[model samples]
Target: MFVIGIDGGGTKTIAILVSSTGEIVAQATGGTSNPNSIGIDEAKNELLKLVHSLSIQNPKAYKNVVSVFAGLSGIESPKYKEEMKQILQNQLPEIAVTIDNDAVIALFSGTFGEPGVVQISGTGSVTYGLDSKGNRHRVGGWGYLIGDEGSGYAIGRAGLHAAFLEKDNRGPSTEISTLLLEYFQVKQIDSMIPLIYGERARTTIASLSKIVMLAADHRDQVALEIIKYQSQQLGEQITALIQISTFQLEGKIPVVLTGGVMNRSDLLLNDIVKTLKDHGINQVEVTVPKLPPVAGAVIAAFQAVNKNLDKISFQNRFLEDYV
Candidate 1:
């Protein structure tokens, strides 16, 4: 039997087909399918498109698929998970489907199935961890309204606020205004108000972190301060996770960072590390994901079917292109 693993998020959906023995056969991609961002209907359509495309490309393995593990965004509530599971299962009947939050897959991929902490900072942010005793803990995944402090959206929002403050002479002048203008492709900062508040505002604002990064690279004091502040927020979340989980503080803890913001901003990464050390998380270790989140979904699928991840020899040449 074959297993299908999917990592669905705000930016895109990735599907991978792997054999029972962990050999990767094929992979496919589709547009964003996060139910919260695109609505349930659109999310279902995107899932269907993704699955159909994969099936079409690998017709020989389509009927052999036995199980599917999808780690998706907008699965914060059980209601969304149940609705999405029913929706996706309806598309491919007779196959068992399991759903979880995107952060879970990132954690699995980050730790390679071991116990560790994973921090995600894309359109939204969250820090989740699993301890050696199989205990799981989550912190700061509170969407844009209340939290998501260190997320790309937060950074972008701060960037916009800084630009406006500079424009009004309420704050020191910074190069972020020019960068924001270029990023939004607007003649003036006022032109962005409509777009930012128009539709999918969270995603639109989140994408503007690039401008903040550019400004910081050019030594924009305001931009650097924003990044530093966001880093501290992320560090606080991680620290909280460690305090809440059954993780050991004496030994080095592998802290994996995922998402666009974590990967793109060096200054933010440095500040986060610094903040962690300052908070008595001295033995904390940080690294990037060794495998993609979809691969992590595949690992979850292996566990779901009573299979051992370490027992699978996925090093065969057929799977050379993937981990």
Candidate 2:
């Protein structure tokens, strides 16, 4: 049997085909399919195109696929999820389709569907935890406009704010000022206004978080402070999840960290771990994901079929090689 897994985010969509034996046979990519960002119809179309492309090269594999697990952004509402599921089911009537928010699969990817916490800090930040009772709670992820306190967008915005402050001689001089100026290629600090306010503003700003991390690596005080503060915010959110979760509070609980921002920067990761420890969340066990989010979707597919992943040694080894 074959199963398909999809990880759909604001920026892009990825689909992977896995054999029942756990070998990845094919993968495909498409443009952003976040229902919130692109409309439900567009997102559905993107996914359909992706799946069709994957199947075009290997029709037999596609036909044999029994289940599809998709993790998507902008699926917070059950209405949206059901709508997406219906759209996908219509496209692949022979297959069982499961749809959930990106975080759900991310958590599953990290913990293999076990109860655990996953902290995502990419363009935006959000922390999700699953309790033993199947209850899930999410903290943050309000977007760049409101929350997303400890996200790449937040770090980038903080760096930009500090740069602006320095330009106006209102804040301490830091490497970020020059870094931002260089990154944006603006003759004057104010010149960044038009580009920032232009197209893909959120992504453009969030991309700058890398520069902030670079500055922090160089021991820039302002950059370090920004990372520290953001990490603290994320840690606090994790704490909130722990308090309300049904998971054992006293023993070790798996905490998984994912997303580009957190994955790219050890300084930020260290700061977050430190903050967690300082907050008395010392018993937590930070787990390195054994598989990517797409693989998590595959695991979900297995569960949908009432199959146990632990019984498959090849699947475990396949996931280990990739991670």
Candidate 3:
């Protein structure tokens, strides 16, 4: 028998076919299946495309498929989950289907389906945790506008604000101003105004986070301050989730740090760990996932069928065949 696992997000969707023995047999990718980013119909179409591709890539494994677990972004509401479940059920009538937020798979990626917390800080940010009793909790992930305090968008926006402040002589001088000008390939600070307000505003602004990271690498005081503040905010979210969950009582809690921003910058990651310790969370066992989030979905597929594959063996097989 075999199972399928899917990780769907605003940017893209990835699906994999894994044998009961934990060998990855086939994989496929498709465009965004996030119902919030694209409409439900379009998202459904994208998911179907990915499944069809997987079947075509390896028909034998696809035929043996018994269950599917999809961890999708923007599937917060029950309405969206049901809609997604129906879509998968309609396509693979005989297979069991499970739908959940993308963060679930991210957490599972590091914990291997064990109870733990995962903090994601990419274009957007969110913190999710699961307790031993199966109770789940989430913090942040409100998107770029109102929340996402420690996200790439947040860092980028702050960098831009600092650049403008220095330009207007309202704040301390920093190299971010010159870097921002070069990044947009413009002569004056105001030249990038139209671009910033353009259609891809969120992504465009979020992209500036790399520039901030670069400045910090050169030991820019202003840029370092921004990272410190953002790391503190993210740390607060993690601590908040821990306090609200059963993890607070546990002697040691697993905390997985994933996503582009957290993974790319050792500086930021170190600061977050420091902030957690400062907040008295001394028992956190922080880990960076060796397996991708999609692997969590695959593990979920196995658990759905009550097949308990050995963790070390599964990781070895998955890494050899899929990673």
Candidate 4:
């Protein structure tokens, strides 16, 4: 039999067809299927297009498909999950369909579907944990306005705040002011106001995180402090999850760190690790996923049907073929 797995998020969607033996038969990518970003109809259309593309790539494999698992962002509520599942099932009448949050696939990507925690820190941030009993919990991911403390937007906004403080002589001088002026191609810091409040305000602010990372790498005190504080916030989320969940404090717990900001900045990763250690959580085995979250969706498909994939062999083949 064959299975279909999908990972859909705010930016893009990936779908893959896999054989029972763990061979990836066909794959396709398309625009975002996130219903929250795009309307539900558009999201459904995007997903159907990608799945149709996969079928066209390998009709024989698609014909044998038995199950489909879709891990999507912005479908946290049970109402949304049921709505998407019904839509997919209506289109593919004979197949079994499952829908869940994108965070589930992210955790599976790192833990091979075992119990673990996944912390995502991109333009926004969120922390999710699954205990051994199959109980799941989440913290943060409230978006830019209220939460997302350790996210790229937060770091960038902090950098911008520090620059303004320096300009007003209310804070110590830092390299971020010069960096922001140059980054925005403005002759003076105030000239960036209009550009920052433009249509892509959130992304624009998030992009400034790279400048903050650069400044921290150069040992700028303000940048380092910003990173330090953000790392602490992230660490607190992890620790809080552990304390609140069924996870044993002394047991070997896997922690998967993914997302653009977490992946790119070793300095920030190190700081987070230090924060965890300082909090006396030594049993956490932190790692970056070798495969993307879509792989986890595939794994979930296999699990849904009481099937299994050889973890090491699947990883080797997938990295060779897809990465």
lDDT of each: 0.82, 0.83, 0.88, 0.87
Better of 2 and 3 by lDDT: 3
Over 270-290, each residue of candidate 4 has an lDDT whose tens digit, in order, gives 877888898888888998898
Clashing pairs in 1: none
Give lDDT tens digits, candidate 1, residues 1-323.
77788999878899888876667777888888887878888988887787888788787887788778899987777887888899769877887789988888888776655678899988889998877777778889888988998999999999999999988889888899988888778988788899799668988888888788888989999999999999999999999999883665347888989888876757788888888988888877787764678877877777777766553355242246563
* TM-score of candidate 3 versus the correct structure, residues matched by position: 0.93
In model 2, what lDDT does residue 247 have?
48
lDDT of 3 by residue, 1-323 (tens): 89999999779899999986779899998888988888888988888888998989999988889999999988877888898899899989978899988898988888888888999988999999988777888889888989998899999999999998988889998888889999899998888899799789999999899999899989999999999999999999998998883543355889988888876658787878888998898898988887888999998888888988788788888999885
Alpha-carbon RMSD to native, per candidate: 3.5, 2.6, 1.9, 2.0
Q: Return the top candidate by TM-score.
A: 3
Each candidate structure's TM-score, on Cα atoms with residue i matched to residue i, is 0.83, 0.91, 0.93, 0.93
lDDT of 1 at 26: 75
> Looking at candidate 1, what is the lDDT of residue 60?
84
lDDT per residue as tens, model 2, 1-323: 88888999878898887776677777788998888888888988999998888798678888888899999998877887888899889988977899988888888877776778899888998989877667778777788999898889999999999999998999999999788789878788899899898768998999999889889889999999998899888888888788763544335888888888767646766777887888778888886565778888888887888766763564576565442
Error of 4 at 32 (Å): 2.2
Which runs in model 2 stand beyond 4 Å of their true positions? 245-251, 310-323
